[model samples]
Each structure stands twice: as structure tokens, then as C-alpha cells.
Target: MNADQVLQTIKDEKISFIDFWFVDIFGELHNVGMPSYAIDKNSFVNGLEKLDASSIVGFKSVNNSDMILMPDPTSFKILPSDYDPGNRKNARIFCDLYDGSTDESSRYNRDSRGIAYKASKKLKEFGFTHTNWGPEIEFFVFDTINVYPSPYAATHSYGGSGYSIESKESPWAKGNVSTAIDIKEGYYPSQPKDTLEGFRKDVCDDLYNYFGIRIEAEHHEVATSGQCEINLEYDEMIQMADHVIGVKNLVKVKAKRKNKVATFMPKPIFGDNASAMHTHQSLWNGKSNVMYDKDDEQAQMSQTGRYYIGGILSHASALCAISNPTTNSYKRLVPGFEAPVNVCWGLGNRSAAIRVPMYNRNQEKSKRLEYRVPDPTANIYLLEAALLLAGLDGIKNKIDPGDPIEENVYKLSPEKKREYKIGSLPVSLKGALDSLSSDSKFLEDVFTKDFLDVYSELKYKEYVAFAQTPTAWEVSMYADA
Candidate 1:
């Protein structure tokens, strides 16, 4: 859409307010609202509108803080809600941040949206035209939640009391016998066991109507209580990143309207499956999928594909610093959970960080790699940019991803893994940061050192806080000692 089209949209939809939304380094969405009457289509589209960057993490300091927001006309969408009915409708647009004060106004390196866009542009230098991405986002819905933390004590609890199988309305409620889904068994259960189907659909409907993002599938994930997964059709990295943030927003909004809470926390629940945003990626060179070659015996994967996987494996440890940024993210990466913890590539092996999805030779377009290491907590822009850069580095340097491992990597002994040159993913936020501190050259150009320093410092503080915090387990283990 152009400037004129956006004006028409505001006029036609009776949008009273427009929210310019952008993502911080922490993947949190920040918005600046403007009355519809105040929008100057030409000026806004040209990047005249400014925002205070001092308060936004990973941006400039207070002394040098004004950032410009160039509203991407293509990202115009209606904010789905009944809060303000009829003519009082609200709309949203994704913006790209830039250093507006400079004579040569350039995109801020910390502007995650700009970073991803710049990273995507690098594909042309490598002879690839575009990178297509599909992310399978998993989340949980809780009927009630309370997270209270203090300097001395902390407690976070969440569960569905009324929606349990023992509820009076549930089918299992009558026998007084427990019919609740066993831990890690929540995949594809019917209405009684899976109560969030309608909720997921409502969110999907809004995504489709509001942003034209197509949903490939929506169903209960492998967690007993309210865990769900929503699959979106693949698109380029920048657009897909926007869709990811948009999906999260719409899902939470829909969940809240139904008096439930939705969270993308990697490990919100203990001893059950954790949520992950497994991304499927394929490199395209114009009309052909560059990652596929039917003549190749190895899952019909091209030489380029192998090298890309090699790059991803080589940089897996460092990439985790951005891909799985949270301290809680490491909890989900441990063994016993379905999330990938090994730095290896294999066909149909979910335990490996990179998996070459198994498909028929006839289905060349389906031949792509699924990066399973990332969780939804990651900043989508940075995550996509980091992945692309690593893969591109591999292609340029001809990194050799060793033979595919068919065995379950989680079950492999340490000695066995070493023999195969397989390595474990960083087990903690601190570990990932340490890996990033040394091996971040692959991410250097796209993710500038200035931004990375801020990112690392912020993440280190998170790790320190978590490391020092006393938990119930600590009290239980050594109360008297």
C-alpha cells in the first residue's frame, strides 16, 4: 500500500487512532499512538515522525536519543478488538527506526527491523534472491496466573482450575475419576481435553483478516494443560518477523478477552513440554529453491543446503545468545524436553538443532531446514538476522556439515558425541553469552558491536540475577546445612 492507500484505509475504516509499533531488543513491543487526524501521509511515510529512544532499551543514550519511525505502508492493519466499536476503531503499523538527527540519516543498528532487512539484503551478494521462513509458534493459555516476586521471596504460579477434566462440565467430571491429560500428552485431544481450539481459531481469523497472514495449522501441542501451536505460511524474514510479533499480540488479546492468559515463555511450566518457535527456512534463487537438488542422495539436499546447515551448527552456541535470549530459555533446552539441545544436523531428528525435514523427492519445494533451537522469547528480527548471517557465512566459506545423525542425539553419551564431533548447545544464558563473546564475528557486520555490547550487558545482568536468586529448591535442599 502507498501513502494514499493508507489515508483511504483510515478514512474507510473510521480509525480514530493509529499505533506505530516497533520491537525492542528484548522482543517486547512498544507503541506510539497518534490521532488519525494528525497523520500526514507524505511526511510519515517519508520518516519525519520521531520517537524518544532514550527509554527504549538497546537504543541511544539520553543525550543523543531522538529516533525516526518510518511507517511501512505495506504493514497497515486494523487492530482487532471490540473495546471501541464502530467509528472509534484502532489501527496499527510496523515502523523501521532510524537515526533521524544525522545529515546522512541511516537505520539504527539496534533497530531490529532494520537489521533484519539489511541482513536479507545481504542475500543478493551471495547470489540468493530471498530466504523464505515458516515459524511454528507454541504457547500456553492459563485460566489464572499470579507472579509475585520480592527481594526476599519469589513465586509464580499458573494453571487452569475450571477447565480441568474434573470440572462439573467436563466429561470426566461425572465419574469423579481423573481424566486429565497426562503430562506431555496434550496432542490433538478432542474438545473436552482441548478447550482452546475456538480461542486459537479466533486469533488465526484475526491474523488472516487483519494482516493477511495465513495459518497452515492450529492444534494442541504436547503439554497437558492449555499448550497450543500455531503454524503460519512461509514468507521472507522481515515480513515473517512482523507476523510473529503480530501473532503474539493478537493471541494474547484474544486470550484475555476470554478471561485467560497467554504466554510465550519458554519454560512457564516445569516437568512438561516447553514452548518453542521452530523455524523452517529455505533459500530461494528466483524461481528455484536453492536448498534443493534432486540429484543429490542426501535427502535431495543441495551442496548449498549442507553448507548452510554446517554454518548454523558451527555458530549454534553463539546464536543462542540471541535465539534463546532468556535465562528461562535454557530450562527448556535441557534434555527430556522436546526442544533441541545438540548442535548437529539430521533428517527427521528433532533432537538436533538443525533438521532437514524428510520429504518425497517429488516435493522439491518442501526440502528445507528446520531450526529447532529458537524459542518465542527471542526478538524475531535479531533471530532471523543471526540465522541468515550464519548460514550465509557457511555458504561463503564452504563449511562442511558432517554426515547426518539418525540416532536420537539426547540419548547419546558424552564420549559418543565427542567422537562424532557433535556438541551440546549452551546450557545457560551465561554460557551462551560466553560463547557469543568469542565467536560473534559471524554476526559482527549485521549486528554491530555497539548494539551487541548493550545486548550482552543487558543479558548478563539477567543471568546474574537468576543465578543469585534463591529458589524453593535451594531451601528444600539445604535449609539446615
Candidate 2:
């Protein structure tokens, strides 16, 4: 939408509040609202809104904290207000952050969305028109949660499983625990078992209606305790990142309205499947799909696609720092949870880090690689940018991705893995950070050194903080040792 269209929509819809949205370094949305009367073409173009950078994590020091928000007119939308109940309505617009003091109003170096824009521009320079991304974001919805945690103590308790279910409709209330879906076996079950169907539908509806996200599919994931997934249609890189934040927020808010809790945490449960955001990506030059080849001997992917996979595998370790991005994220990356730890591409193999999905045959548009390392915890802007850079590097260097492993990677013997040249993703946050520190030349082209350093320091501090803590398992296993 143009500025004039935005104003006309506000006027026609009687929108009272216009919320300006932007992301911090971690992809968390921050917003400031103004009365609709305050918005005009001049204010929208000149970028009058100011934000305190020091208040945002990994942004700025108190000495140099001022930043400006310039709302992108194209991102203007009418959002359903949570607080307003009268005829007055609400709307939202995604903003790009700029240096308030700069004469040119240069983009903030730490703005993840801006970084994605820069990355996309770099892709065009490398002969690729654009990079497209589709992410399958999985999350868990719980009926209730209770927790207590501090330096002196930590304990958590929740109820959703058959053992502690309090719902009167639950068979467990009538002494039929067998009615509960078993752990790690909740994929595509019907109604009573999939209690979140209505909720997930509502979430998807809101995402489509208000946020402009086109959801392709929604269903129960491979975890018994309220795990679900909603697959959104593919979009351009920066737009996809914005949609991810929108979908997550919509899901959480809709779940809360039903007195439930939604979590994108990689490993909220100990022994079951953990949530993951498997990102499918492809490169294109206008309407033509550069990643597809009908006559390729190995999988219909083109030479460009192979090189892109090669780049991802070559930098798999470093990519984890941004793709996984959390201390708890490592827990989900471990074996036995269907985690894609093996650094190899495969056709329809879930265990491989890169999976070439076998869906929609004869459709060149659907030919793409799904990088399986990322979780919902990642900053989408940075993660997508890094992925695109890796692919671009591969195209530039003509990196060979090696053989596609057809067998299940998890079942491959150690000797077989060695023979196939398969390597593992980083096992911990510290390991991933170390890998990024050593092999981040690709990212340096886009991310400022200071910004990367700040990001690394923040993540490393989290790792150290978690390492310093003693867990309940430690007390149970080593108290006597």
C-alpha cells in the first residue's frame, strides 16, 4: 500500500491507533503506537518516530541510544486490537530502523530486517533475482503451566498428558489412560486426541486474515503433548521473516485467549519430539526457477541448487549459531528426537540436515532444499540472510555438495558416515559459537563486525550462565559422587 492508500484505509476504517512494529537483534517484535490522527504522508516519509536503542538488547549503549523508525507503507495492515472494544479500530505497520543522528538516515547496523534486505540485494548482484523461503514452524500448546526458578531453586510442573490431565472430557478422568496419545506418536490424529485443532485453525485464520500470511497446512506434530505445526506458503526472504514473527505472535495470543500457553521452545519436554522450524529455500531469477532442472541425473535439482546445498553443508556448524541460537536449542539437536544433525543432503530423509522433499512432482516451483537445523528460537532475518549468503558463496565458488545419502542418517554406522563424509552439526551453543567465530567470513560481507561481536558475546554469555548452573539431574546423579 502507498502512503495515501494507508491514510485512506485508516480514514475509511476509523482506525484509532497505528502501531509501528520493528524487531530487535533477536527477532522479537517491539512496537510503539500513535493516534491515527498523528500519521500523515510527511511523517511517514520523513521518519519522525524515535526509539531508545539502549533499551533494546544488543542494540546500543546509553551514550548512543537514539534510533528512528520509518514504517514501510507496503506493510500497512488493519490489526484486530486486543485492548480496544469500541468502534475505534487498530492497525499495524512494519518499520525499518535508522540512525537518528545521521544526515543520510542510514539503517541501523543491528536491524535484522535491514540485514535481510541487504542480503537480498547481494543475491541480485550475484545473478540470482531473489531467494525464497518457506518455514514449517512447530510449537507446543499446553493447558496450564506452573514454574519456580531462581539461583537457589528451580522446579516446574505442567498438566496436559494423561497422568495429570484435569479436563473432564479426558478419558483419564474416567480411568482410561490408554486413550492418551503415546509420547512421540501424535502425528495427524483426529478430534478428541488432537484437542488443539480448533485452536490451530483459529490461529491460522487470524494469520491469513489480519497478517496476510497464506498458510498451506496445519496439523498435529510428532509429539503427544500438544505439539502442532502450521506451514505457511513461501515468500521473499524479508517478507518471510516478517511473517514468521506475525504467525508466532498470532498463535500465542489466540492460545492465551483460550486459557492455554503456547511455546516455541525447542525442548520443553525431556524425552519426546522437540519443536523445529525446518526452512525450505530456493533461488529464482524472476518467474523462472533457477533451482530446478528436469533432466538432472540425481534428483530434479539444478546445478545451482546442488551448489547451494554444498554451501549449506560446508558451513553447517557456523549456521547453527544463528539457526538454532539458544542454550535449550542444543537439547533438541541431540539424537533420537528426529533432529537433523548429520551434515548431508538426502531425498526424503528426515535425519539429514538438508532434505529435498519429494512432494508435488512435475512442479518446478516446488523444487527446493529444506535445511533442517533451525528452530523457532532463531532470528528469522539473520538466519535467512546467512542461509542465502552460504548459498551465494557456494554458487560463486562452485562448491560440490558430495553424494546424497539415501539411507536414514541416524541409522548409518560410524564407518558408513565416515565413508559418506558426513559431519555433525554443533553439539552445543558454545560449539556453534566457536564455529561461527572461526568460519564467519561469509557473514562478514553483510553483518558488521561489531554487530557480530555483540551477538556472539550475548550468546556466549548465555552459554556460560547456563553452564554455571546446576540442574536437577546433576543433583540426582552426582550428589553422592
Candidate 3:
């Protein structure tokens, strides 16, 4: 859709509000809405203008804060009536940020969406037309959540600061313990045990009807406390990232409407399976799948695909800083939780960071690698860009990925691991950040030096805060000593 078409649709659909939306560097959605009467073709072409970039995290500082939001008509959509009060028609369009500080506006260097666009364009330079990404989004829903202050804070007349969550599916839930799902056994139970079935269906329906995001499947995940997974149909990189944003927001909104709280935090519950966004990816040339080689006997993976895996494995530590940005994200990446902790590739091995699905062998389009390390806490745009750049670097250098490990990586002896040359992902956010700081040249194509500096600074602050804060477990371990 063009600017004119967007305006015509607004008039024809009687849309009262047009929401101009853009993502910040942290992948949080920001918007400014205007009445339909105030919208025109110029509004789309020239943008609504004058966003305070200083206020947004990882954006410009106060000295150089001005920015513009150029709405992409191709991303226009009329939101469901439930989105507004009184059923007033409201529409939304995703925007690209532009520098408003100068007379001639240009794409903002720190804008994540613009970075995604640049990353997509970078594919053409590598002789590939495009790439597709499918992210298996996992999250948890809770009935209620409560937080309390610390003992020191209570003594000082300050509020408490610890949290507790509840879910009917949890063993700790009052009266529901009898019917609660066993730990790590919530996969595909029928109606009575699967409390979120209706909820998932409703969310999926809205995703398709309102946002045009196709749902491949939705079901209970292998965790006791309301864990769920929703699979979306694969699409081009940028579009897929956009779909991720929409799906996350919709899930949260729908959960709130039903008096439940939804969280995508990687390790919300200890001693349970952690949520992860296992991204399935493939490179394409026009209509051809460049990742498939039917003649290959072992995995049927093409040379291009093997090189891509090599790139990801070589840079897995650095990539973790972006893909698992949060402090809680590290908690999820630990062993025994089904999260990939080793830097290796394997066919049909969940423990390996990159798993080439064996189920779709010889099926040209379906032959792709699943990167199993990222979580929903990541900024999808940045994560996708970094992954693509690293893979391209691998291809350019023809990096050898070594052999595919078939055995469980977590079960491998220390000596065996050393012999296989398998390395582990960073054990903490600080470690991951340090790795990224040392080895980030591969990301220079799309991630600028200035952007990296700002991003690193912001993420380091998060790491420091988490490191300093004492948790309940720490108190329990040391109070008697």
C-alpha cells in the first residue's frame, strides 16, 4: 500500500485514530496517535515528525534528540475494535526513524528498524535475494504476581522488592495442586490440564484476523507453570521480526484483558524448562532455497548452510550478548533446562546451539538450521541483523564448522568436550558482554561503532544492577552463616 492508498483506506474504513508506531533500540514499541481528520498523504510521506529521541533508551542524548517517524504504508493495519474504547476504529502503521536534527533528514543510525532494513539489503551484496526466519516464541502466564520489599527496606520504612507469581497450573497454587501439571511435563495435555488452551486459541485468532500473522501451531510447553509455545509461519527477516513484536504485544494485551499476567522473561521459574525463541533460518536466492543440497548423504545441508552454521558457532558468545540481553536470560541458558549451552552444531540435537532439523530432509524449502539460544528478551531486529551478519562472515571466509555432534552435549565428559572442541556459551551477561566487546568486527556491516557503544553501555548497566542486587536464594544461603 502507498501513502494515497493508506489515506483512502482510513476514509473508507472510518478509522478515527491513526497510530504511528516505531521501535526503540530496546525493541519496546512506541507510538503517537492522531485523529483520522488530521491525517493526509503528506503525513505518511513526510512523517508525523519531532519525536524526542533523548527520552527513549539507547537513542540520542538531549543535545541531539530530535527525530522523525516516517510511517510505512505497507505496514498499515486497522486494529481490532477491542484495542479502543467504545469500538472506535483505530489503525496503526509501523515507522522508520529519521534524523530531524539536520535540514536534510536521513535514517537514524541508532534506529533498530533502519538497521534491520540495512541488514536485509546486505543480503543482496552476498548474492542472496532474501532470508526467512521462523521464531518459536515461548512464554509463561500467571494468575497473579506479588512483590515485597527487603528486610532492610522494611526496617527503613521503604517498600519491599521481591516477587512471587501464581498459576493454577503450578503445584504451589492453592487448591489446584491436585490437578496441577507435573514439573517439566506440561507438553500437550487435554482441556482440564491445559488451562491456557482457550487463551492461546483466542490470541491466535486475533493474530490472524487483526494482524494477518499466520499461526502454524500453539500448545503447552514442557514446563509446569503455565508455559506455552506459539509457532508462527516463516516469513522474510524484517516481516518476521515485525510479526514477533505484534505477537508479543497481542499476547500481553489479551492476557491482561482476561485478568492474567503474561511474561516472556527467560527464567521466571527455577527448576523448570526455560522459555526460548528457537529461530529457524534459511538463505534464499529469488525462489530457490540455497540451504538445501539433496545429494548430501549426512544432513542434506548445502555448503552455504554449513558455512552459516560455522559462522554462528564461531560468534555464538558475542551473539549471546545481543540475543540474550537480560540478566535473567543467563539464568535460563544454564544446563539441565533444555536451553542450548554449548557452541556446536548437530543434526536433530537440542543441546547443540545450531540444530539442522532431520525431519525435513530432502524437502528443499524446509531444510534449514534452528538457532536455539535466543530468548524473547532480545530486541528481534538487532538479533536478526547480528545473526545474518555473522552467518555472512562465515560464508565469506568459508569457515569450517567441524563435525556435527550427535551425542547430548550436556552429558559429554570434560575430556570429551575438549576433544570435540566444543565450547560453552557465556555463563552470565557480563561474560557475554565481554565476549561481544572483544569480537564484534563481524557485526560492523550493520551495527555501527556508535550504536554498539550505546548498546553496550546500556546493557552493562543492566548487568551491574542485577549483579549488585541480592536475591532470595542468596539470603537463604548466607543468613545462618
Candidate 4:
């Protein structure tokens, strides 16, 4: 769908208002509201409007501060929301950020969705079209939370943030016992034990109704304390990013109203499973799944598919900088609890970075690879585009991944695993950044040097801030020594 279809749908539906959506560098959502009268197709597609880029986090600068929002008509959705103008009445379109002048500077340089768009366009130049992505975002809903730590706090105390949670370490510092849901018991556990089925229901309903996303499923994950996963239909690279940004916004708002807070932090607790956004991907060749070759013996996998997986795993270390891009993200990448620890692929294996679903309903297109390293904290657009390009590069160059292992990778005989070329991803933020700095050609092309400079500076600051913090663990380990 193009801008013309966008205006026609609104006019035909008698849509009252339009929300032009965009994201900042930090993957936060922002919008521009417009009256129906300003719904010009060409103008929307060209991204003609005045806005300040400096306001976006990490995109801060005083000099070249111009930005514009160009609507993506295909992303038009009529949501069931308080903000929604009565069912199908208020419509919204995801937009591309551009410069105000002719030869529009990419307005979305700082936007993940924009970066994905740029990357997808670049792929077409190399004779590939349709960059596809499917992100499985996981999050936790808590009854309450109340702890804030700085560089100097002695015990990271928080006895008075209100909203009592039965299992938190904050108020009494008893450290999550009793009220915490049992480990691994939360998956599909019924109403009373799962507790947040209402919220999960509400989230799925709101997402589907508001965003027009046909959620494939919503279920309680293995993590305790209300961990959940809401998956939507696969979408193209850029729009899927927009949907992701929108999902986060709607989830937070709805969660707040329910007298709770939601977080996608990879690890919010110790000794329990952490949240992960395992991304599932497959290429298409005009209505066919290119990843599946029904005639092949290895899970009906195609050679092109093997190359795609190869490229992704080869770049696995560098990819983590973007896929698992936060300090807390490493907390979830640890061994055990279903977290992927090494760069490996196998048939129906969860221990490897990529897992192929074992039991499909005898469908060919259902074939896909699940990249298990990503967390919900990532900018979906950039993460997906990067993986797609890596895979495309592998396909273009026929990068072989050797062979797929069927053994339990985590428990593999140490020497045997090494012999098979298995390796671990970066264990720290600094390491990921360093890896990205080296294997950065793909990322650099999508995000210009301007973006790279700003992003690196900001991420390093975050790392330093984390490094400077005085944690209870540090003091406990060193106070007496």
C-alpha cells in the first residue's frame, strides 16, 4: 500500500484524525497528529513537515536539527483505544523521518524503523526485495516495583514506592520468596497461578483491535512473576519495526492503567528465567517460503536457507551489539533456563542460537529459523534488517555453516562442540560494542557516520554509567575484604 491508498481508505471510512507515528534513536515512540484535511498522499510519502531532530534521544544536536515525517500508508491502522477515534474512526500511519529540504536527509537515521528501511532499499540494489521479519517480544508485568540505584547507593533500598508486591526484595529486602511464581511453572499455567491472564488478554485484544495485528498467540512464558509473550503476524522490515514501537507504547499504557508496571529487561531477577525475544525469520520468493525445500533430507531445508543461517551465526557476536543491546541483556544470555549461549544451529534444538521448529502441522512455509539471542529491548527494525542482510550476504556468497548438530548443544562433549565450530557471543556491553566496531560495514551503511558517531558516544556513556554504579553485590563482596 502506498500514500494514495492511505488517503482513500481514510476518506472512505470517514476517518476523523490521523496520527503519524515515528521512533527516536532509543526506540521510543513519538507522533505527529494531523487533521484529515492535511492527508495529502504525495506530501505524506515525501515526508514534508517541520520537526526537531534534537529532541530525539541520542540524535541531539543544535545545528542540523531539521526533521520531517513521511507517512507509510501500508501501516495505517484503526485501533480500539481511548486515543482511537471510536472503532476504525481514528487512523494512524507509521512515518519515515526525513529532512525538511530537497534531497531529504534521512529523517529516520536515528530511528530503527528508518534504518531498516534504508537497509531494505540497499538490499534491492543487490537484487533482493522484501526484507521480512518476525519478532517475538517478551515482557513481565509486576504487581509493583520500587528500587532506584545510582553510583553511590549502599544497599539499593526502596521501602516506600507504594504498590505492595508479595515477592519483591525492595520493601523488606527479604529477596523474592513465596509470592514469586515457581520457576518454569508459569508456562500455560491456569488463571490463579499465572495471575496476569487478564492483562495478557487485554494486551492481545488491544494490539489486535488497535493495531490490526493478528496476534498468532499470547501465552505465559516460563519465567515467574507474570512473564508473557505476544506474537503478531510477520511483516516487512520497516513496518514491523513500526508495529513493534507501537506495541511497546500500547503495552506500557495499558499496564499502567492496570495499576502495574511492565518491563522487557532481559533479566529482572536472579535464579530465575529471564525474558527473551526470539526472532523467527524466513525469506520469500513471491508467495513461497524460500527457506524450505521439501525435497531435501535435512528437515526439508534449502541450501539457500543453510547459507542464510551461516551468515547470521558468523556475525552472531557482532549482531549481539544490536540484538541484545543493553547491559541487562547479558543477564538473560546466560547458560541454562532456555537462554541461547553459543553460535550454533540444529534441528528442533533450543540450546543453539537458531532453532527450527520440530513439529509443524505438515506445512512447508511454516519452516523458519528462530534467532534466540535478541531481547525485547532491541530496536526491532535495525535488528531484523541486520540479520536479513547478513543472511542475504551469505546467500549471495554461499557461506556454508558446515553442518547442523542434533545433539544437545549445552551438554555436548566439550572437545566435540569446539570441533564443530561452536563459539559464544560477547559477554559484556563493551565486548559487543567492540565486535560491532569491527564487523560494522552493514550497520555503517544503514546508519551513516553521523549516526554511528552519536550512537557509539551514547552507548559508551551508558556503559560507563553502569560501570560507575555501586551495587549491593560489589559492597557485599568487598566491604569486609
lDDT of 2 by residue, 1-481 (tens): 8999999999998889998989888888888989999899886777865789899999999998888888888888887554345656789889888896333439888999888988888976777788789999999887765553344453334211121323322333454354466778788988777888888888887788888899999999988778899999999988899899888877787777678878898887768889999999999998888999989866888988999899988999999999999999999998898998789999888889999988666678888999999999999999999999898889889999997899989999999999999998889999999999999998897987888999999999999988987776776778799
lDDT of 4 by residue, 233-301 (tens): 888776677778878878887877767788888888677788888888877766777788888866788
Report the number of backbone clashes for model 3: 4
Deviation in Å, model 3, residue 152 alpha carbon? 8.1
Per-residue CA lDDT of candidate 1, range 1-481, in tens?
8878998989987889988899998889998888999897565646755688898877778998877888888898888773344547898889888786433238778888888988998999989999999999999887765643444454334221111212211232345234466678888988766777788888888889878999999998888667899999999888899999999988887777777778898886668889999999999998799999889876889999999999998999999999999999999998897888888989888888888888567577788999999999999999999999999999999999999999999899999999989988999999999999999998888888888899999999989988987776676678689
What TM-score, computed on C-alpha atoms, does each candidate reach? 0.93, 0.94, 0.97, 0.88
TM-score attained by model 1: 0.93
How much does each candidate deviate from the true structure in C-alpha RMSD? 3.7, 3.3, 1.8, 3.8
lDDT of 2: 0.85
Q: Weakest 10 consecutive residues, lDDT, candidate 2? A: 159-168
Off by over 4 Å in 2: 81-88, 101-105, 149-151, 154-179
Give the alpha-carbon lDDT of every model: 0.84, 0.85, 0.88, 0.75
Better structure of 1 and 3 per TM-score: 3
lDDT of 3 by residue, 1-481 (tens): 8999988999998999988878888898888999999988777667776599889988877997877888889888888765776789998888888885322237888889889888888888889999999999999999987767663552455643468888999988878845599888998988788999999999999889988999999999999888999999999988898899989988888888889999999888879898999999999999899999999999998898999889999999999999999998988998898999999999999989999999865699898999999999999999999999999989999988998999999999999999999999999999999999999999876788899888999999988877877666776788699
Candidates ranked by TM-score, best first? 3, 2, 1, 4
